[model samples]
Target: MGTLSPAAPPTTPERTKSRLLEAVKDCDCATAQALADKLGVTVPAIRRHLQDLQDAGQLEVRTEKPGGRGRPQHVYVLTEAGEATFPKAYATLCVDVLDQVERLFGDGAVLRVMDARRLEFQGVLASRLAGHSDLGRKLTALAAVLCEYGYAARAYQENGQWYLTQRNCPAPAVAKAFPQLCQAELTLYRDLLELPVSREARLSCGAAECRYKVG
Candidate 1:
């Protein structure tokens, strides 16, 4: 069976901040104890972490009761600023990709090449997700790993294929305009993930570089 491992754990406080922010982005509220339990850390450790995060304005805490509860409990939620941190890694990745593209394709041709690369990337992801029984679970796993590498990915089903869309690119303004750049990214995706290794199989980008579907 093919299995994937999750991204490595955060190694620094700043990375921890980003992870915490991403974890709570969709959760309306979470308790310190609940967070500690989820993260597998001691309650005191979670309290200290939350205090530091709150001081940095990455999170806000308030006490509230949900009617059946005996007393109000403090719940932690991400601030607008906290949510902003989740995309910071992506912005960094874009800079690195754009710099390399400029070196290889000239500044003028970089964006075009990169956009095309992005489409090929989508095809690689589609190929990986093709035979999975639980598309959403597989995508969530894939996106989580991608998020760690500086791309905010979201995947959903379209027709019989899974479509993975990138909301933010480190080279956003350029990546949005050039399809070739996206195509180049697809090449990197193929190489990095060990995809399309078969002699008879070929990966190609489609009509829209922003979207890619594999057969």
Candidate 2:
């Protein structure tokens, strides 16, 4: 006879972890108590799965004050990696299906799909800037937007130019991450007559006010 089929693996652990992650994604963030409450499990059970996910580097655990709490409560947030596992797959499936449908439906459908995706990412920066004025506002706006772009951006002002310190670059993540995204940001100030603009930057991160010169 052929070798017996390998025993089916138990899915309890995976199910528990998936449910816990789903709780965080659905809630955006969750504490053990919250997850337990959501999943109708004990706090200890939820904590165990949370620890496992954190250990696996799929979740970021943070502490938050729960008002009457003696100290703080541990809150679990799904790391990008964790969300990537399932939600992204579903999204890819949807997009692939839609593309096939568009092929038969209309040619402009594909262009519309691309335009919508672009607008969704583009809106991130615009929403972050909401309302502000002048250079500080500009720096704050730029930092906020760049952070969304996955760059750990910080700004400092000195002399006349606002220097942006990029702790992380998102370019390599995107085939054409548009390095010019920065230049485009700088150009936003060209027409604003608040103060003369200067692109001359001197690298400094250790000074009291790290030299990010903005006039």
The global Cα lDDT (0 to 1) of model 2 is 0.63
Off by over 4 Å in 1: 1-11, 26-28, 67-69, 88-215
TM-score for each model: 0.36, 0.36
Per-candidate count of clashing residue pairs (backbone under 3 Å)? 24, 9
Candidate 2: tens digits of C-alpha lDDT, residues 47-97: 888888989889998888766567787778878888776733544555556
lDDT of 1 by residue, 1-215 (tens): 97999998757766655555665675555887777666667788778888998898888988888564778889888888777775457645765676776788787767565556566666766666556656466656666656666766666676776555554454555444444555566565455444441112112222222333322
Q: Report, for every candidate in turn, its global Cα lDDT versus the true structure.
A: 0.61, 0.63
Best-fitting candidate, scored by lDDT: 2
| Clash number for candidate 1 | 24
